[model samples]
Target: MLKGILEGCVLKVIFDNETYGYEISQKLQEHGFQGISEGTIYPLLLRMEKNGLIEATYKASVLGPRRKYFTITGKGKGELEDFLTVYKEMERAVHHLFAQRKPEADSEENTGFGEPEWEG
Candidate 1:
């Protein structure tokens, strides 16, 4: 199943400027996402627009139906900022949790005779 949370994250990421869902999905795939189906993204886009988090404008598509482009609304911008803050803090905390730290040194080893081993 697709992660709805990541879908919203991707939407906000693209909604930072005008963009379409297909392009957004392709970018998401390129940006290390997997199992992100159009089924998952299209509905979320609709929901966000319904909630006034975004606005959609249609553009002509030569090969198919007109394409709809979405942009972040002021409300979406506020939400994106809040989401970005929380996401960054969580990312930093996770990084710290997963980060490796140097061990305390013994007096004999502390004279820059050798380097500390690194991991993670």
Candidate 2:
């Protein structure tokens, strides 16, 4: 599910500044990208490069080996903009569907996936 959406994820991360692969991976990990692995991240980077959505350049590190850094291209920015539309629509639809139910008092702590206290 997230495989096809990584372009958006990668672009979101780099929208702030240029970053190396390892840094990007660490950031994604911190953000709770559930299925993302280092193996999965690079290929998406390559594919994004192939599509001209992002550009990668290598730089020497002072304390370590050279690192490949990725930056979001104008095309990638435009693609992310497009994704925002789709993502917002999806979010709205999902929220609308789920918002119809009332949450149980104790369910605020549970997301209703594994250990649920909510009826929805």
Clash number for every model?
A: 0, 0
Q: Find the candidate with the highest TM-score and give its number.
A: 2
Provide the TM-score for each candidate, comma-separated.
Answer: 0.69, 0.76
- Model 1 lDDT per residue over 1-120, tens place: 134457457656666568888888877787777766667688888888998888899999989999999988888887778777877887799787645344543333435233536733
For all candidates in order, the CA lDDT equals 0.74, 0.79
Clashing pairs in 1: none
Task: List candidate 1 segments past 4 Å from native.
Answer: 1-8, 100-120
Worst 10 residues of 2 by lDDT: 105-114
Report model 1's TM-score to 2 decimal places: 0.69
Q: Global lDDT for candidate 2?
A: 0.79
lDDT of 2 by residue, 20-91 (tens): 777888888899876667787888888889999888899999999998888898988999999878888888
